[model samples]
Target: MDRTRFFVRVAAVYALIGAFMGSHMAGGGGLELSAIHAHILVVGWLSMFAFAVYYKLFNIPKNSKLSVIHVWSSFIGVFGLTVGMWLYYTRPIEGMQTFNTIFFIVGGTILLIAFVVFAIMAFVHGKFISEE
Candidate 1:
């Protein structure tokens, strides 16, 4: 499913969001969103871009179910984690602390699982390959 392209595109979106947040903060926006901005840049942009490069340079089997899981979970985890963080920190609405916390934790857990799966894939199929 063109995982490399997919990951890179998603990562680009995260990069823009993170950049905007940084610019906002520089322009006198409070530091309230600083942590969220950092996480989005790191986990969302950097990690995803790295993963995309991995897919581009490695010989992970196209049919591997593990790759699918890792890719999707990475996307979901980033989205959930970033949105969850913003919600929890901003408290845009009332009485949603528990929801926000749960959402953040679940996203982190999913990202962890994706990392574990990536490690497993590296062990199982991270062979070098010629350009396709």
Candidate 2:
């Protein structure tokens, strides 16, 4: 399948898993797990899936290597951020505080880069209509 569709599907799966885990954690009453679950559902699932749908609906060129790069980078970035949060919350480190901070910053930067690239590609595609 196309990259956009593929990513959307993957994001959906992540969302479902996040929901399940969140509910389970809530039922058992754990604050840390709940927070991690929220992060995964919101960032990893909802945001990523929304971006995928946006890219697909906008008809981003399949051959655009930049779009491909954006997709992969954003995916990895979000995945890392979510996973890192999960790790940090579940296994609180006593002195390795910098590790979690670095993970978040790196992931956020990667996602920001992906957004910039995606915007550039979309603008270059001339899909936007100007009422001059």
List residue ranges in candidate 1 displaced over 4 A: 128-132
TM-score of each: 0.94, 0.78
Model 2 misses residue 72 by how many Å?
A: 0.7
Show model 2 residue runs off by greater than 4 Å: 92-97, 128-132
Cα distance off (Å), candidate 1, residue 32: 1.3
Task: Work out how many backbone clashes candidate 2 has.
Answer: 0
Q: Write the per-residue lDDT of candidate 2 for residues 17-98, one digit (tens) a residue.
A: 8989978877888765776788788777887787777766676677878878888887887777776776566557677667
Ten contiguous residues with the weakest lDDT in model 2: 123-132
Tens-digit lDDT track of model 1 for 45-88: 99999999999888778889999999999999889899988988
Best candidate (score: lDDT):
1
